[model samples]
Target: MLVDQYNPFEGKMLQILDQEGNITDEKLLPEIPDEELVRLFKIMLYTRVIDRKALMYQRQGRMLTYAPNEGQEACQIGSVYALEQRDWMAPAFRELGAWLTRGVDLKTLYLYWYGNEMGSKVSEEIRILPVSIPISSQLLHAVGLAYAAKVRGLDEVSIAYFGDGGTSEGDFHEALNLAGVYKTPTIFLCQNNQWSISVPKHFQTASETFAQKAYAYGFKGIKVDGNDIFAMYAATKEAVDRARKGEGPTLIEAYTYRLGAHTTSDDPTRYRDNTEVEAWREKDPVKRFRIYLEKRGLWDEEIEKAYVAEKEEEVEQVFADIEQNGGTAFDDVFMYQYAEMTPILKEQYAEWKAFFQERGML
Candidate 1:
């Protein structure tokens, strides 16, 4: 098994592609069909464009505080591509690439970030939870979902996406422990982007690698090259297969880097050095995947230019639509907290409306 072959405790990190984008071993390359590989690249490009435009909109005060997924595209898109339609994904807030790859609407993301509560509404067909902003809380929800699936005699695997910092949260450990003991079909995907909102990886944990933490909870752990799309896909596909076969859970620590600020409100420059950022920029995931596609004759500069232009136009229109008619409805704010709002909630919402009306601000 790939998990056994690349043992995290032994300090072995999987790297199917090097920084220069050359495949390290032909045998290690994932069996993604050529067409699907091209689609993955196109989606990754679209994700990057959306992320960049979101940053621009936030800076211009057209949106709320937003997280940027600049350098971690492969870590999300690749793993999500490995998922079958029946699988479920629970994502932390920064998983813009995964959100897009997993069939989320482009306008929904924009509306959500633009302070519209309606943006969080998703179709019943999509199996993604609303973005969990409170650290590693989503992992617990994923475990519950996985356990529920097992009880229902279904083989649908659940994957939870989190960051390196989330590993420190109590919810992280509790979720892993429960999944381990229950032998739930959960895939813990932690994007160890070398920082937990400004805390370096070394300070986050004394263990040599975050993947090693899985051993304490009784499952296999894999340390992988997050920037290498092939490695991410292979690891996730293997993990997904293992889960469906009732092999229990696996924790995958994607060793990636955050190329942008923690969020729109953050200033990475205050805590990190430019030289370090530049060094990681050389290993940018999007660039590495593009190089891989070029080598496979699936992509070129001309295709990239046209594809980027099309995505830019599409993103602009999505945002434009949101601006024109997608603002949050006043009633939506009070309706979703509970199936039926309690008297306190009703009073609070009504009191706010009365205040706004008194000031002619409603």
Candidate 2:
């Protein structure tokens, strides 16, 4: 029959489960206990609910433009949970789930979307950077942190999260090159959701797969089923452990789909079809994980109800907190810039504060 020879690039790739909720590789599965699995599920549910609420808030003009991580919860949660508390996280926009999993306050996330810069005033104790919106710029920051850690003889690693579109940026290549040369402890986590805003992955690059690019950088590369929480956790755990052990960086390409608009300001219907969205919905990460939980007799209707109710209450409190704080204030904007504000910045701040006061808006 002259069947083609097998290649790592021409295979189904590494995975622990299928969309039908069947375990395909028992040995590669994560050793998550039942309680931990339940907690993971609850976190995903909470994120989903929060995303929905944020969408509603945007429509009601209560929040500025917001990005929704509707179907990629498992990818974010699994990857972040796999990291140690000492490890750093440098994220691009659309990493709400990762930040929340890393102990960022839900109210802070809400405040960020509400146009408050204070939302990004993460505690110095938390090893997370302010959300980078300039595409792949954070990759360099992650590499720099990794290099510094290595120079200081620190075992900590830094994980940088970006989308498929980010791979095309010059900063991405530069960061990877530096990480490779320095053998920094950095994990380049690329969430290939198949779309970068309205641009589809196929148009983003001609490469067969995003993971293959890692070969040019002389590092291990992996492509996993992003929708599978088990696969994500296992792969990330291995990468984090390797980095902590003084191994070089790894490139993890999570092949997943974005089930909603890129952001509230975007409309996917203009660039794609409903059929595609419907197809990905069938592989919903939350639903698949729920099915897996059910098969093990670990999930029930009562649990589902209770979880949803609790999530709703939590989201409600976040919204109330944001609203009561008058959303974002003008003074909050000038607090984080520098120890001493520049004269120009001080003048601008005073002008803004005066303008708000004149309108009785502050």
lDDT of each: 0.92, 0.87
Best candidate, lDDT: 1
lDDT of 2 by residue, 1-362 (tens): 00011123665456677888999868677898999998888888888999999999899988899998998998899888899889899999888778878888887788888888888878887899999999999999999999999999998999999999999999999999999888899999999999999999989999888877877897777887899998888878888888888878988888889999999999999999999999999989999899999999999779899889988998888798788884555676787678789898899999988998999987
| lDDT by residue (tens digit), candidate 1, 1-362 | 88999998777999898888899989999888899889988989999999999999999988999999999999999888889878899999999889888889898888888989877877778899888999999999999999999999997999999999999999999999999999899999999998888899889999999899998999989999999988999999999999889989999999999999999999999999999999999999888888888998999999999999999999999898888898777878898878899999999999989999999997
lDDT of 2: 0.87
Q: Tell me the lDDT of model 2 at 189.
A: 90
TM-score of 1: 0.98
